[model samples]
Target: MADNKTVRFGLLGCIRFASKFVRTVTQSSNSVIVAISDPSLETAKTFAAANDLSPENVAVYGSYEELLNDANVDAVYLTMPVTQRGKWAVMTAEMKKHVLIEKPPALDATELDKIVEACERNGVQFMDGTIWLHHQRTVKIKETLFDSGLLGDVRHMYTTMTTPVPEQVLERLTKEAMGLAGAIGELGWYPIGAALWAMSYQMPISVRAMPSSVSTNSVGTILSCSASLQFGSTTTAIVHCSFLSQLSTDLAISGSKGSVQMNDYVIPYKEDTAWFEYTSGAKFVDMHTGWNVMPERVTFDCGGTEESQEAMMLREFTRLVEGIKRGDLEADHRWPEISRKTQLVVDALKKSVDIGCEVVHL
Candidate 1:
């Protein structure tokens, strides 16, 4: 039986994203959001009230240190800005608190290594909060496409995830906020994860990317990219990602015998059904609803499962903490490998964009 002890969680930074996560933890059976800290007291109180957490149970700290010092917090969820995530992760690790940090855990590999070492030394579990990896859809896609051998030997993979930049997000795209590596950092990781997962983490043989100079910011608005990845004996893949225009969140893979396609790759909710196509000749045949194979399609009508990304992330974090307390290290080992490989591909893509040629040995 799973241990029934509640993992007391304190959320750092009452940012807009934390609200949904607070609600998820409140509803989770294995964990609770016992404390919250933000620079603004009013914001913290408002979040607590909206989430139905008692104001007394919610400690509004003026600074993160105040929250870190609290004895009641067994672990922490770090959802601050990408630039500050490494610092917070290191701090939390030094304090001996398990941490689930937001994506791009660090701006560079050096910072990621430091954060990893800190967590190791402190004897705490550390994970990058890449929510999609935790979702069941990823596993199902892998099994059906790779394990089932339904598609024969995989050859090509393409994914598109695009949406208009929110006004708030546009405002923060300045170099001062996210540096010159804009869209690649903010949006490229999703496709990177998908491609890597599909290839079963086989390092790509070569990668190339080109950013269209359409936006005013140094971070290009439109990115046209192609990666040549080799997996096993005869499997080769061409993968693409862009932040340029509106295309359905689509992922299509072609093999020697047949091809499989999935629409709505990034956010596949219960209400949203993904379209699948298999190529026979010049025509494509639509497969039955892909929901049965995609476990994330399993929905809850009540307080548990919802459409909030933040909620899904928090629930997964709670599961990780529970595993940690029980000395289960399997999940912990996989995180660093996946994170490092994802960053490596991102780096290769940037190099390809800069040199106007394919980057090899990524």
Candidate 2:
């Protein structure tokens, strides 16, 4: 399966987010953009042209089903809204194509179950568009957390992501939330993922959303939210995500002896490099004065200077897809397993919100 071949990719929607992926697939060594399907023919065609997809290999369709039947596509990227993605993922798998979907892969456990079961039954690899998971910078951090003596016990982690949403957007989301912040599944996905990643994808024992911490509309649409997650008795996590605040996303991890901090964890400030600070073994000086430890800044240069986080994801996806195509491997479950863990926590967070911030038993 590790032969030299390009993994043909089909874009399911021309969502603005898909443009980054278009570039990544075209630039990747083992991937190529071969088809696009969306409701609007012009939207799909324009996107294809802007990306400079070859006309001979790249086809455009006004309907997703037509693209799925093209026979040229080996994999499809689903970029629909979270509530609608589950049905499409199942359809993609049933059509015998590998599926890469946007984050929060499904709205809840029931939908996630359908996606996982379909992918497994159809023998198609499944992954979410959580680009950070595939970033080289995140790779370095994982090493420091697991292998390095820094941040010894992983006792606590805090992750926050917030970006102010316009009135129009808020109006749409308010209607969508129904009663509570139905949009929690969307904006909260990143912080939830960061928390889960910091905890090594272990499901927390329970979750308690911050009571009275959400900003809602008259009908109770969640504009902002915060939650507390408990893992056993020692490990805990805090997550805050909102659509009513200024753009600020951060992560900090602390243990018994030391800590780590980053200003941008969901998406790096730089495309080619990521920055963070870590400290270990802090103690007062012999004179019982200032602390003895000093924080050291570190940066990791991802190999591809032009490769965005999305590019890294496509490169990884294509490599595995290439192997599967060459019969070198079956569907790799590693990515889907991680995705499932993230979704499990996401569902729990929603439950917490649903029950008025009560502790949701996992």
Candidate 3:
């Protein structure tokens, strides 16, 4: 980086949702699309054209290694499959380029430790692409969580992200050759990350996955699943994610003082404002004849000029990249720590399910 210049973003893997981040990086003032890499140059070119990148400014490569080796590339936004992310992340780290990866990047804690180690050794930044946590709503929500006079001592949280997979995606996911981790690693990761984030990355003492019903494809990939997390005392969280259900994404947090409830936690339905409600006190009126529910609904722009979570996420990531280049000391550890904790809980949930309702200790 030239200190006064935009951070160069080299996008790796031309996945379906790659366009979202591409658009975000282009919109952000701190970042630019310097290069793109995929298995085919045509595919990369198609992506670049869709995102409206200029051929003279953006380089397209058919190989990820070539993109990583490009001198102009400063950081990489990786949108690869869950299983392949670890390999590419380590490679990116060894190459000394900062990494911003999609969620569930680690298959287990062992792999996550290795990825974290590589980045630390190379003095590069590492962050997972969890969208909602970067939103302005999250900032306000964290403030409310600490105000005991408001939401008080958070106790429990429940979140869900269930949406029907497209026909092409369903076929690719269920194929034996792909051998993907199934819906748990795909749609499940967002809500699970939300649950972990609600408690400030506090590791649960134990985890149990208790899905009432399980559906698998013809090739044996799980289509849907759910789990619960125990925080050892009064705190707990539950999450449900699926690939075989209608579109739905929501989260509710309960506390000693009140509760927080909202929909569209994974992605905002609109770009302008978000909706969430909280309640402080409630009671029955006239001998239980009627109920008085004190619910306060909130709607705000959340300071998002780009509107969507992905855009906000990219802006924040780019800011950190530039800040670090300018010698900021407090930027790197925060993202990697959150990413590691999220992956640790996801690994525990999968282990609990595999062992027949056994409680996996974290």
Candidate 4:
């Protein structure tokens, strides 16, 4: 890592999802993937070839340890399974390399804490792969709905992120090797993060999973579930996540003066522009045929012309890593804090589900 130089990255897994990062990192201006590793050397080589990665530029390794040992590898992007990532992330940090992990960062918050602690102790940066948060649309939403007080005192939030998964895909998702074999761990992270973001990253007082809403596979891997989070006496967030629903990503936030609504909060339908609906001070007309005000459609152009949300995330993480390398800045604690808060809520909700949908105090 050097000032005004590209931050080299080692991708630690050759899974299908890792391909996305391969493209994003290449599209990013500040980062580049220099190495790739998987359990099988042949698989790593094949993945690199499929991605059209030049051998002279990208090293292929059969073991993660070998890639981590490469001095040119400034950081690591963990695309491994949820259960296997924590130790590897800790190892990455221990070797004084920054780590970017895919979400849900771990099976539970306790596990996430260990990874974060390692980064803190080793003076490395740690960020979970929550791409939507890095989108320009998210920045606009924060300004209009939160900072501008357009939504007033927020009282309620509803979010759902789901997609129909085929049987083969569902089997892969629910495999015991994946650790958390459920829609909650796979798709729920978005809504959970969205709810926390709407509440300014505040922790909920309690979480209760709706028992009736929980559906599981033959292996007892959760396929779909819903949960309620009590933020305060007056504020609550309802989240529903599923692998058995029609494709949808919805978020709605209501406050004292207004409400914010969007159908695609996790990933916008279009890459160039994303929009939301906002409404306030509504009343029925004298004839009671319609409301006094209609919801306003607010749209924002995706700010990064060549950068998607995932690209922006890689750029931002690399920027931080560069700053640390330059000694002009310390690791930004905010990213890890956000990750920890989201993990805590997730753990609480999972606990609630395990305890017969009983409310779990945070």
TM-score of every model?
Answer: 0.80, 0.93, 0.92, 0.95
Q: Which candidate ranks first by TM-score, i.e. highest?
A: 4
Q: Model 1, range 118-197, lDDT digits (tens) per residue?
A: 88788777778777665555555567656777667667777655656655556556655654445566566777777777
Pitting candidate 3 against candidate 4, the one with the higher TM-score is: 4
Candidate closer to the true structure by TM-score (higher is better), 1 or 2: 2
Q: What's each prediction's clash count?
A: 0, 2, 0, 0
Candidate 2 runs further than 4 Å off = 1-4, 174-183, 218-220, 286-289, 303-307
The true-versus-predicted C-alpha distance at residue 301 of model 2, in Å, is 1.7
Over 4 Å off, model 3: 1-3, 166-171, 174-180, 302-304
Residues 199-257, candidate 4: write the lDDT tens digits: 98888899999999998777777888999999889999999999899998999999998
Point out the worst 10-residue segment of candidate 2 by lDDT: 174-183
lDDT of 1 at 36: 85
Q: Which candidate tops lDDT?
A: 4
Q: What TM-score, to 2 decimals, does candidate 3 have?
A: 0.92
Task: Rank by lDDT, highest first.
Answer: 4, 2, 3, 1
Decide which is better by TM-score, 2 or 3: 2
lDDT of model 1, residue 17 = 77
- Compared with the true structure, all predictions reach lDDT values of 0.66, 0.80, 0.79, 0.86
Error of 1 at 123 (Å): 2.3
lDDT of 4: 0.86
Cα-lDDT of candidate 2: 0.80
